[model samples]
Target: MCNRRRRVDLIEPSVVGTRNVLNACLKAKAKRVVVVSSIGAVIVNPNWPKDQAMDEECWSDRDSCKTTKNYYCLGKTIAESEAFEYAKRGELDIVTVCPSIVIGTMLQPTINSSSLLLLTMLKENFVDSMHVYHDSFTEVDDCEKLSSEKLQDLGWKYRPLEESIVDSVMNYEERGLLLKK
Candidate 1:
């Protein structure tokens, strides 16, 4: 899912892999399953009311995503949709958590896509060319703010945003991936 190089590459892992995981969960008789979706799946729709805050109810238009060539969003939407459909069969309880751009200290030696994005922004002249395919893929101008209200209601706690950024930067510096500035 992290690889945005090819649209074709996204289909197998996101859609098929998600279904396989759900099937395995059903077979295992798991009581509850949580699928980590992305905000990309929720807020990518242009049809959402401008003044209304997007919530779990909102779904990105799949056709719109395809027309715009936003494969990442398309993949996430399809995967999440399939997950809900599987859950609707009433075999197992399924919950989908859609998080916005996550930034935190790295647990592994290598950097991940989110951290890499933060790194690119932190460092000057990181890439030769940056092509933004569409505004919806990168930004959500209509919504007032991205909310964690749903997660908060579930008693999920997160570290402060400042702490996350600082920790990530420190981790990058310690790993010699980023020079101390």
Candidate 2:
């Protein structure tokens, strides 16, 4: 029988991961750690202010994640939250970066979920599901615009989205991640 991903699977492991990693970091007397979270932890908030742009301060509402059945978002929300809560003890300086649908070069041999979604769109023009996106950021065709202000503030620079797309396609082809027709 084929197994399926479940909310419990996502949420429980994230909670455990945070516990184990933090414990190890504390035990080793690590001075700092940078957690790479996703924009799912921000935009999944159903109660997001309509006119306000999403920023680092925004967090996905837990109830909203649960209601929308966005298990990844739920997991990220809990994991990042638990990590930050533990970091608040001042024992370690834990910084975090919450990136949005990253449409750029893949560093690893395997394409990431964000790149996979884009490739799927090109091939099938379909997606399994999407989170409760703020209406203002919704686009039926083109990729929606998201504010990367916080990341920018941290000196994170990015190539143009169009350039990134072209580069990703080329990279995918080189890596043979794209299905041959």
| Best prediction by lDDT | 1
The TM-scores, one per candidate, come to 0.78, 0.74
For 1-181, candidate 1 gives per-residue lDDT tens digits of: 5445678787657888888999999889899999988887887888977677778888889989988888878999999999998778887799998877778778767776787788877665332212222222244565445567888898989987657766776777678777634
Number of the top candidate by TM-score? 1
Across 1-181, the per-residue lDDT of candidate 2 in tens digits comes to 1113587787887778877888899999899988877877777865666667777678889988777788888888888888888878776788777776777678877767888877776445422122212222234543333577766787988887657766766776677766646
| Cα RMSDs, all models | 7.0, 7.0
Model 2 stretches with alpha carbons more than 4 Å out:
1-5, 124-147
- Give the Å shift of residue 36 in candidate 1: 0.8
Q: Pairs clashing in candidate 1?
A: none
Q: lDDT of candidate 2?
A: 0.72
